[model samples]
Target: MCTRYRVGASGKKLAERYGAVEAACDAPGVEAFPKRRGWAVCAVKGELRLGTMGWGFPPPPNGRAPVVNVRNLASPFWRDALARPAQRCLVPVTEFCEWEGEAGRKRDRWFSVPSLEIFSFAGIWRQTAAGPVYAFLTCAPNALVAPVHPKAMPVILHPEDEARWLSGNIAEVLPLAAPFPSQLMALAE
Candidate 1:
């Protein structure tokens, strides 16, 4: 799961690239961790808008920490949030990191498609009592990520497919949820 990722561009550049308004809050840098406030391009009332949102869903009623990765689309926990296509958002990232090592000796390795300066994760967001919260989807890891993290990796949307992910129906977005092409990604030590 993508518990951490990187967002290095300024809000103005993100807004311009994604055709959204500049976010009004601070943007994260090379290392954005879960539960932190970050900027995402979300459709507000059918218009794409860049806004600051916490990178997690609200804690469960039992009061657990917020969840950062959401992979179960069929689960009741996310059904209401995922039902509306408008809730979809694009999480801009330079790369995402995965840990490699034993429990206390883990080291981070960053992964990205070097051919593109920026990319987006298929994300979902909603208004909560705390504020707006957003989380990205994850899928089984592809070859590149599987060696480092055998479990899963964030579902990255290709630059050309960003609009479809943001506006497409469940049927359209479902097909786009697979792991990104492993050959296109590069790893950084």
Candidate 2:
């Protein structure tokens, strides 16, 4: 579900890479955890801007848990965000971790796109009562992530698709929710 990931670069570097204006905020650190603030590039007033947003949405009415990895686009909870380009965001990431092994013995397995020093996940953000929060989409795992996290993997966007994800209509961006190419990804030792 990508509960944890690494940014691995300064805010200035990330903003530069995404062609966004940097916000005056503290760095989110190398490793990011759920509910913590992390850097996200969002379109504001038709301009891409980089800023920090808390991970995960506020708990739903049923009080299940904070929504993190969004997989169901048809759900009422996520539909509005999916239909609006302004709510779409780019989650900067260097590497993401998935746990392997049994409950007590599980160990983290990190994966990264070998060709990108920094890549982005297809994300969505919203203004909640607690403030702005963000979550990335997930899809069925690929050959590389399936062994470690068979259920799902974050939707890592290709550099070319980043713009489409942020501005394209639902029809244009929905197809991008598929898994990234396994051959282009590397599992860290």
Candidate 3:
């Protein structure tokens, strides 16, 4: 859902607010997420760590589809791969991109954010022998993002709920996504 974003002064403020310590801005193709560039995954050291994952969530063995949206998690095709809810470290991010227009004449670069300056995104990760890989989980768009991205949006997190999200439990923070509010995120007009 949130495929692209601009990380300017706003990102700096977000980093400080969330106490995002080490930044691993090696998200392979930075353009995939736009101004948010190069897999900007943030970690809280002993607390938690996260970053932009390969947009398409490549399925496990025998599964060739790569799903970036949770909507597919329940699909018969991917339910097997996503049957289990994941609680890995993820930050949906304060802003992301969507497109406007018909397929042939479609326009990209739809920027979305919350009423607040920046919001954290929900994500999941697996413990690997090397380290951790994160993905910005997706969900249906709220009224705000619906017109912009028709498909979905990454799970946006409340600033105060960061700790709870780290636990990987979706129930505790389900209510936050409701009552979507409009934020004043400008695209450098």
Clash count of each predicted structure: 0, 0, 12
lDDT of 2 by residue, 1-189 (tens): 789999999988898899899988888879999889999999888789999999998766996778889988778889999999999999999999999999999999999998999999999999978889999999999999999999999999999999999999999999999999999999998
In the predicted model 2, the residue pairs found to clash are none
- Write candidate 3's Cα lDDT for 1-189 as tens digits: 555654333334444656665354443432344222223333344543334444445466786654444554445544332323343454534456676778899676555453655555655444334344445556776676677676776666666666665643345544444424436343321
**For each candidate, what is the lDDT?**
0.85, 0.94, 0.50
lDDT of 1 by residue, 24-43 (tens): 67666557788888878987
TM-score of 1: 0.94
* True-vs-predicted CA distance for residue 148, candidate 1, Å: 0.8
CA lDDT, candidate 3, residue 28: 43
Worst 10 residues of 1 by lDDT: 22-31
Q: Give the Å error, residue 141, model 2.
A: 0.2
